[model samples]
Target chain A: MTNAQGADKPLVLVVDDYQDAREMYAEYLEFSGFRVAQAQNGAEALEKAFALLPDVILMDLSLPIIDGWEATRRLKSDERTRAIPVVALTGHAMAGQATGDQQVSCDAFVIKPCLPDALVAEVRRVLAARKASAAR
Target chain B: MPSTAPLTPPAAPGSEARTESEPLSADRERALLWRLVDAVTDPCFFTGLEGRLLIANASARQLFVADEASNAGRRRAVELNQRLLDTALASLATGGASAVRRRDLSLVDPVEGTDLLFELVSTPVQEPGCTPGVVCVLRNMTDLGRATRALGESYRRLRASEQQARSERLRLDLILDSVADPILLTDPAGGTVLMNDPAERLFAAPHDSGEATRRRARTNDAHLSSFLSHLLSPGNARRWRGELPLVEPGTGAPMPMEAVASKVLSDQGETISIVTLLHDRTEALEKARLLEQLRAASNKLEAKVHAATAELAEQNEKLRRQAFQLEQASAAKSQFLANMSHEFRTPLNAILGYTNMLLQGVSGEMTPQQRRNLQRIDSNGRHLLQVINEILDITRIEAGRMPLNAADFELPELLQEVMAEMDPIVARTKLAVHTALAPQLPPVHGDRQKVKQIVLNLLSNALKFTHEGSVQVSADSAPATSTVSISVKDTGIGIAAEHLEKIFEDFQQVDSSPTRAYGGTGLGLSICRRLATMMGGSVAVQSTPGQGSTFTLHLPRRMRQA
Candidate 1:
C-alpha cells in the first residue's frame, strides 16, 4: 500500500505472525516514504513475494503454514524471486548463524523486538549488498 | 685115639658125661666150641637129642639158678629146664641135619625186678654117627626199639616245617608280583639278585637287537650301582626317598621316577643288600604342570576383572561429572534467556515506538488528551526499561559474565551522587533521606560502575519500602577488616521476620501481593547482593516486624588487580 507519493517510492514487503509487530513495522516503513505490503504467514509471504515482486522482503522466522526458513529456501531456489533480498527476523539473535552441520541461508538477520530504524537500516544494507553482487 | 677127658664134669645138670671115644681132630673141635660158648655174654646152652641138658654157659647157669644147686631135689626147676630142653630137641628133630628156630620173649629178671625183652635162637648141631643136639641163644632188644620210635617222631616234625617254609616263599612271590610298582633286590656288589615281574617288565630289553639288550644291561647296572652306593654310604640315611630322573633302558627316553632306597640288615647287624622301590611319575608331573598353567590363567583373569571394574568405576564417575556440568550449563542458558526475554522489553519497544511516532506526528497531529496519554506511555516504558535493566544485571552476575570495572573512587562522593540521582523518587515519598560518612573515609576499590549501581539499587529499595519515616544511608570502614560497608535503613512498614531473608532473593518482595501497592521488579536487593558478592563482598539484612529493615552492602577495600 502507498500514500499520495506512490509511484516514486521503493516497495517493501513485511511478514510477521504477530499482527501488532507487522502493523508497527509496516506503518514505520510506509511513514518513511516507502510502499509496503504485508503477509501474516510464510505461505502468504511467498505468494505475495512472487506476485508483488517487492524490492526487499522482511521475513519473520516463526510463521504458520510454512516457516521462514523453508520459504526463504524456496524463494532463493526460484529463479524469478532469487533477486529479492530477504532479511530474517527472529527472537533468537543467532538464528542465521550456522548450527552444527546446517548452514542457515539468509541475506541478513535481525533480532526480534528490534528498533524500527535498525530493521530499516538492515533492509537497506542487504539491498545494497544484493545490488553489488548482481552488478558483479 | 687120644681124647681129652672131661675136664670138668657136668657141673649142674640133667646131663650125662660121655667117655672119651672121639678121634683126636674131633676132640679138638669140641674143645674150641666149648670155649666159644662159654665166652658169649648171651645165655647159651647145649642139650642132648634125648631131651637131657648136656651143658650150659655161666649166663645160662645164672638164669637156671634153682637147677644149679640141686638137680634132683628141685623137681619143678628140673621140669622147667626140661621144657626148654624139649623145645631145643624138638627143633633138632624137625630139621634133621640143620635146623634153626627164633622167638621173641618177654621175661622178668629175678635179680633186677625189671622186664627184659629178648630174641631166642635155637640151632641144631649134628655130626655123623654122633648124637645131635640143639644150641639156644637169647639177645636183648629194648634200647634198639626205643631209638627207632624217637627217630620217627623227629622225621615227622622236620617234614611239616619244610612244607610251611615252601608255602611262605610262594606267598611272598605272589605279593611281589601283584604290586604295580617296580621293585628290585640287589646284592652288596650291585648285582641284581631278584626283581618282581613289574621290575623285569620295566627294565626288559627293547626286543630290538643285542645292542639294545646290552644298552639296557648297562643302564640297569649303573642304576643298581648308584642305588647301592647311596644306600651303603655312611652319611646316607637308612631309608632315602626322592624324585629321580631316569633314562628308560629300553626306549632310551627320559622318565620321571619316584624312588625309595633302603638297606637290608642281617640279624647280626650287617648290611646284606639294598632294596630300591620306584614308580613312574610322567603322568603325575604332566598333571602338576597343567594345574600350574590353569592357576596362572585364573590369576590373569582375576587381574583383568579387577582392572576392568576399576576402569568402569572411573568411567562412570567421569560421565556423572559431565552430566552435572551439562545440566548446569543448560540451567544457566535458560536463566539467561528468561532474563533477556523479560517481555517488558518487547512491549516497551512497541509502546515507546508507537508513542514516539505519535509524538513525532508520524501519522498526523494528535489531540491534547492523546498527547498526555502518549507521554504517560513514554514514562512507563522508561520505568519498564529500568526494571529490565535490573533483570539483566542480575542475570549477568549469576551467569558470571559481568566484568568488573575497578578503579579508585571516593565513597562519600559516590553516595552523594546516588542520593542526588534519587532526588526525584525521594521527592515523591514523604520520607526524609539522610547520609552519614566517616570523617576520614577511605576511597574504596572495585568496579566503579557496579558499585554505583549497587548504591542506586539500595537507595531505591529503601525509598520504595519506606512511606512515613526517614531512610538513612551510612558508609564506614568495617572494623578489623579490609572492607567498606554501606548500609541503608528505613522506618516504614517493617518487614516481617520471615520476609527478611526472602527480600534478597530474585523476584521476591516483602509484600508480593499484586494489589498491596509496592511496585518493583523485585530484583533490586538480589542484584545488590549478587553485585556485592562479585566484588568479593556480601550484603546482609536485619529487620523486625513493625520496626523496619536495614540492608548492608559490604565491599572489599582493595579489589584484586588483574
Candidate 2:
C-alpha cells in the first residue's frame, strides 16, 4: 500500500510478471487517491488479495506461477475474496476464456500498452459494475 | 429179270387170269414194268406164293449180291424170303386175306462185305381164284435210316437255341428295370415298344375309380417330340439331347429332366424305335441356386471394402490439410512474438507515465530545466512508440492480415476529430491548422478507424514538416467518379521530383541528412498510401522544395473489397 493512504480509500492489488509495469501502475493508482498493493506473480497476487482484502484486483494473464485465470478463479470461489472485482490487463488478445457460459473470473479486459490513466479508468469501471450489481 | 424189272404183285392177275388174250396184255405189261423197275435207285423185289423169285432189281442184287463166295448168302436169303412168304400165309389164316405182313431186315452183302437194311412186305392174294400162300418183297432202306438220323440231330439243336433266346430276353428286361432314370423304348408313332419299371411309373395312367385320387403324369408335346419325333426325323442326327420338365406326382411343381433320345436304326438305315433316357435335374438346379446367392453376397462384401477404402482416403486428406494449417499458425505465432517483443510498448508506457507524474509534481517538485528535459524524454518515448506502431502496421499490411472496420462516416466530421487529436502538437509547435471542408461532402464507406488513422498521418505530417505557416485540411467530392478527396496542404519544405516517388516507400524521407529539422521515421506517407490502396483509393502529391506541399487522398464513396 502507498504511504499516507487513508483507511477510507479503496485498496487495489496490481499483479504482473513485469516488475516495472506493476510498480508504475501501483504508483499511478496510489497517486489517484487509492491504496495500492503489488504482486509480481499470480501466487503472490492471491496472497496479497487475501491479506489486504482489497476492493479490486488488476491481474496480468500470463504469469510465472498459478496463472492469472486460475488465481482469479480461486479468489472468486472463496467467500473472503468473492466480492472483489478482477480486471485482466494484458498485451495479448483474449488470453482468458470463460468456461462455456460461466461468468468469467475477470470482470474487465484492458489491452496493454495501456496508459496509467486508461488502466485507472477501466479499474474504476469494473469496480462501479460490481457496486451496481451488489446494490441490486 | 434185271434190277429195273417190275413183275407185278404175286397176287396180281398174272396168277388169276384165265383168258388167252389177257395173257398177252399181262405179259406185255410185265415187260414194261420190269423195265421201269430196272431203272429205279432202290432194290425192289417180287416173290410168288410158292416162294420162288418173280422179279429182282439191280439195288436188290447189290444189296444181296451172289458172287463166288456168296452162294450160302443167297440160300439164306432165299430161306428168309420163303419164311417171309410163310409169315404172310400165316397172317392170312388169322387176319383175313387183305392184310399185309412187313418186317425190317439187316444183312451183309456177300460180295461188298457191307451191311444193308431192307423192309419186307408180305401180302395175301385173293382175286376169287388167284395164287395161294402170299406175295412178298425186300425193299432196300439203308439210305432212309441215314436221313432219319440226320433229322433227329437237327431237331435237338433247334430246341436248345430257343431256350437260350428266352433267357436272354428275360435278362434284358431286368437290366432295363434296374436303371434309376426312366428308360423308354418307343416306336416312331409314340407307341411304347419297351418301358422299364421307372418309365412305367413315370407314364402311369390315372388311378382307377376304386383307388385313391392321385396325379398320373403324361408327356407334354415337346417331351413327346424330344422322345420320338426328333430322333425319328431323317435330317436330325441319330441322337438327341434336350431338357424337359415333368410335373411331380403330388406337388405338381415341375421336376426338370435332361433327356437323351437315340434312334434305333435297322440295317437299311430306317428308324426302328426311339430309346429315351430321362435324368432328374433337381439336385443340380439347387446347387446352382446356392452358388448364385454366394456370389451376390461376395459382391456386396467387395463393394463395402471399396467404400471403406474411399472413406479412409478422405480422412487422410483432411488430416494433411489440418497439418498444413497448424504449420501456418506456428509461423504466425513466431511473427507475433518477434514484433511484440521488439516494440516494447509497455516500457514506453511506463516511461511516459513516470515522466508525466514527475511533471505533475507527484514524485516531488522539479526545476524548469528538469521539467524541460523530462518533457523531451516524454516526447522521444512517444515518438518511439509511434515508430514501433508504424512498423507493426506495415508488417501486418504486408502479411495481408490487417483487418478493416468499414462503415459510413462523414469526411468533414472525421477531419474535425483528426484536427482535435493534433491540437497538442499544434500548440507545442507554432503551426496553424485550418479546415476547408466542402459544404456537401458525402459520407464515405470505408474502414472508419483506418481512414481516421490515414487522416491523422496526413495532418501530423503537415504539422511536423511546416516551420511557421498554416496547415490546411480540405475535402471535396468528385460526383462523376463517385469519389472524395481529402487534401493536407502545408507551407513546409517540399520534396524534389526524384524524391517525391521515393518518399512513398517505407522509411524514406526527402532528406537523409542527420541534422535535418523535421524528425520522423518517414513511414507515415507510405502507410497512408497503402491504407488508401487497401480502401480502393489513391494518394497523390504536388510539392516544391522549401515552398509548400499538398498530399491528397482520393477515397471511393463506397468500400470495394479487394
Candidate 3:
C-alpha cells in the first residue's frame, strides 16, 4: 500500500462487504506477487485507497455507502487518483453486466468469488495498462 | 084427650102407646111428624101416585126452590130441571123402584148455577083394597158430585203432561240422529237411558223387538255400571274424559271412541243423568303415523348433507397441505442453488485465476503449445462457468432473493455501450446494426450492474436470434418525468406464440432438439428479465410468430439536477 510498490509488482486494493471474500481475494493477490490491501466496505476502501494509491482496485458493487459505482467515479474524477483502474466484483454475473450497462465507469466486471488466477490476471493486466499510459 | 089414659088398644099386648095414643089429639100427631122430618139433614120429599107433589119438609123446599126463581128464565137451567124430573120418575116406575141417580139440578143463583147428586131408597106404600101410592124421598148429595169432578180433572191433566214430556224427548232424539257423531245420555245411576241412532249403529243391533231392546238395555246398563262407579268417587261433578271401546252387540267388534262426560243435575242438586259424547280417533292416529315417517326421512337427509360437508372440508384441507409442501420445496431448492453457486465459484475462481497467471507469465514462461492449450482450457472453462452462472442467476431470481444495487447512472451511455459491444457479433453475421440515443438523457437511479446485464443479454439475443437482418438499439428519456426506456429490436427468427411466455422461464427453450441450430441453456432472457426488475425497471418482448422481436427495458430516472 506504499508508493514504493512498483507498477509491475503493483499494490492491489480488494474491497468487499463479505469477510470471506476479502480474505480470499487478499490471499489470491498475495500469491500473485502483488502487495494486497483489503477493506470491508467502500468507505474503508476509500480511506485505504488514499493511503495506498494502489494500482488497481477490485470493488464489490453491493458495498455499503460509497458503493463500487460511486467509488469508481470518485477515483476516476480525482487528479491524483485518475490513473488507477477500478474493476467491479459481484456475486451474480448478470448483475455485474447491468452495472456496465448503466455506464458507471469501471475498467471491467468480474463475478465473485471468482477464480483466483483470473482475478490476479485482471489485476496485473489493468496495472500494466495503467503503467503504459503513465509512461505515455 | 083426658080420655087418653082411659082406653088401650083392644088387640095389643105390647101396644100400650098405641092404645094410649088411640084417637090421639091431632095436635100431638102433627107435632110428631114435624119433628121426624126436621131431624134429617137431607131435604125430604114425598110424592103421590099421580106424580103430584104431596109433602116436603122445609129443607126440601129450600134446596128444590133454591134456584127455581133465580134460574127460571135460563135455557140451561130449565133443561137441567126437566132432565132431573124425568130421571126421578123413570126410577120410580121400575118394579124395584130403588136406584141411585145422579142428575144436574138447576139452581137459578148466579153463585151456584147447577147441582148434581146420587139419590137412593124409594119404596112403594099400599092400603087395603085401595090403590097403592108411590112415595119418593130426595137427598142433596151435591158435595160428593163436586169432589168426583175435581178428581176426574186431575187425572186428565196428568195424562196430558206425560204426552208432552214424551214428545220433547223424541225431538231431542231426532236432533242427535241428524249429527254424524255418536251421542248418548246416561241416567244418574249411569245406566243407558237414551242413545241416538248413530250410537246404536256404531254398536249395531236390531231395533224392532221390545225384548231385544230390553236385552240391549241390560248390556248397556252393564257397561254404564263402571262409569257410575267412577262418577261416585266424588269425581262425578268433574268432567271425565276417557277412551272407551263400544262393542257391537252382534259382531263383537270394538269401536274405539274418545269420550267426554258431565253430570246433569236436578233443581235439588241430585244428579239426574250422566251425558257422554264420543269422537272417532282413527284419522288422528293415521296422521300421527305419517308425521313419524316424514321425520325419519328428514333425519336421513340431514345425515347425508353432513357427510357431504365433511368430505368437502377434508378435500380442502388436503389441498392446502399440498400447496404448503410445494412452497417449502421450492424455497429449499433456491437456497441450495445460491449456496452451491457461491461454493462452486469459490474453488473455480482459483482454477481460472491460476490459469490466467500462468498464461500471463506471472509465475514463469511457458512453451507455445502449452500456452495455446492453456488458452483453450481457459476458454472452455469460461464457457462452462458462464453456464453455471446463468443457472445460479435463474435460481436466485426464482427464489426472489436477487439483490438490486440502485444508483444514479446514465441510460444513454449504457445504451451506446450495449450497441458497441453487439456491433462485432452483428458484423460477423453480416447484419446492419443501428443506434438511437435520446438527446440529453437524464441519469437514472438503478442497479448499474443489473441494468447492464439486461442490456447485454438483450443485445446478444438480438444478434443470436437474427441471421442476416439489421439490429437496432434505441434509448429515449422523459425529461419531465425522469424515466428512461432502452430497447433492442431485431429482425430475427421470431418466437412462436406459445414460446413467448415460455422463453422467460428458466432453462426453457422453444424445442428440445440438440441440433436445433441454437446453443444455450435458455437462461439468458430469464436472467435479463430478473436483472431489469432488480434495477427498479421492467423488461418486455413483442414478437410476431414469423417476423422479428423487440425487447424493451424501462427504468425510473433519478433527478441529477435536483
Best by TM-score: 3
lDDT of 3 at A108: 75
In model 2, what lDDT does residue B314 have?
Answer: 89
Q: In lDDT terms, how accurate is model 3? A: 0.69
Per-residue lDDT for B64 in model 3? 38
lDDT of 2 by residue, B330-438 (tens): 5586477445744476677778777877887888899999999998998888888778778767766775667777888988789888888888878898777889988
User: What DockQ would candidate 3 receive versus the native complex?
Assistant: 0.21
* Residues A58-136 of candidate 1: C-alpha lDDT, one tens digit per residue: 9888789999888888998899898888888875432334353223457777765576777777877887887799899
Q: Cα miss at B314, model 2 (Å)?
A: 27
| CA lDDT of each prediction against the hidden true structure | 0.74, 0.76, 0.69
RMSD of each: 23.5, 24.8, 12.7
Q: What tens-digit string does per-residue lDDT give for candidate 1 at B270-358? A: 67887889888988889999999999999999999999999999999999999899879866775666546545556666777677677
For candidate 1, give the lDDT of residue A1.
50
Q: Which ten residues in a row have the lowest lDDT in candidate 1 chain B?
A: B1-10
TM-score of every prediction relative to native: 0.40, 0.48, 0.54
Fraction of native A-B contacts kept, per candidate: 0.30, 0.42, 0.35
Candidate 3, residue B288: Cα displacement in angstroms equals: 4.5
